[model samples]
Target: MSVQDAFAAPRSAVRDVNGGTGAITDTVINALKKTRPWVLFLAILGFIGAALTLLVGIAVVISSMMMGNLEGMDAEIAPFGSGMMIGVGVLYAVMAVIYFLSALYLLRYAGAIKRLSSSLSVADLEAALEQQASFWKLIGILVLISIVLTVVMLLAGLGGALFMGAAGL
Candidate 1:
């Protein structure tokens, strides 16, 4: 589809290469079958990674708390201030949640493919597409966030450099 037409067309107006309403062809089915395993694998990996991250987050928080309670330790002696450690732990926990959600979306998409394999129903195909769309949407949002964060960090670094220079440091 032309770029103009693509933007103008509604989802229902989508057409296949043969200029017909998008239909699940045998090729499409085969592709889905081939890809299902990869999708499932990704989902499993995400789940595992998220679980590990969550564990790390919890451990970090506990360690920080324990460090704060140590009688012989002073703030200057601690590797990191308890507040900073807690903040890092919270960030890790938030990342774990995001990772888990991405994994959940992939798992649901895989399930849709499994159903389509068994039934070859248009409904199943639609469901699979919806799940796939959700996964892509999440990834797109994450990409945007990463870009913004990079820009912010760069600006902050530049600002710090200028400040240090002005202070004759």
Candidate 2:
């Protein structure tokens, strides 16, 4: 069948590209149904992780403030006194937000898959896949950002080392 015909085909009428008799759509739906529970568990776990990350960020900020107030602290801890710990905490909070968003997408996908399995609504299936795609897209973007940041940090560190070497320090 042509691409248009394939797109127009009903779920019950859909077949494999090899012209098999079985409905490929049904197979995918069944697989999604089987995976729903696992996705739900992952979503719950991710949410818990995000909450813990946020708590850790808060703790770090508070501890940094306390450390700054302490007398006779080493000069090497100047960054914490200068609010660098707050920056680190904010970074952690941003990561937690990303994790929370990923978890939300997973939860939505699981719910949509469950609904589609019961009623076989094409809209519900589409929604489920859309959520799954969104989750992957978010992860892909974060990975790319992380790679770029790592490269930039590596270059900065190399530059610092070169400068320090030239200064005989």
Candidate 3:
């Protein structure tokens, strides 16, 4: 037999070179979809926490101003600052949970993509690339929103503190 025929025989003997089983891709996609709702919920929660922090900060400033004229009341009114502190604490905790869950989801997604890419034909790989691009875009948006909320909360706390101190409370 010619060398060409020998190579052809071996190629024909093997089957499903492209990993015919679709289980790996399916598992990855399902995992991503499952985690999406949790991430979205966390994003909404973050926004709500930030808003609460801002409102609490504003209230503290206004309250301090109204009570400024009262004598020997500084120690008694100091407990009012607890609201802002609690808000910051809750927001930080929520952000930490979001970060942890997102990291896990991303790792799983990456593994799935790698497996699928290796097992798919050229055409299938191209399609997966497009899907992966969209997925990353969504994750990026979430990350940006999370960061913005954190920054705004921090600034609000700082502003409230400065305002309260200025009021002599």
Specify the highest-lDDT model's number: 1
- The per-prediction tally of clashing pairs is 0, 0, 0
Which residue pairs show collisions in model 3? none
Ranking by lDDT: 1, 2, 3
- List, residue by residue over 1-169, the lDDT tens digit for candidate 3: 6547554645432234346632234444455556545645654555565566556555655655555545666665555555455555565555555555454444444554555545544344455555556557767888899799899999999999999999988
What residue runs in model 2 are displaced by over 4 Å at the alpha carbon? 1-25, 74-82
Q: Give lDDT per model, in order.
A: 0.89, 0.84, 0.56
Considering summed lDDT, which 10 consecutive residues are worst modelled in model 3?
9-18
TM-score of each: 0.81, 0.80, 0.37
User: Of 1 and 2, which scores higher on lDDT?
Assistant: 1
Any runs in candidate 3 off by more than 4 Å, and if so which?
1-75, 121-131, 143-169
RMSD to truth, every model? 10.3, 8.4, 11.3
Error of 3 at 167 (Å): 11
- Model 1 vs. true fold: TM: 0.81
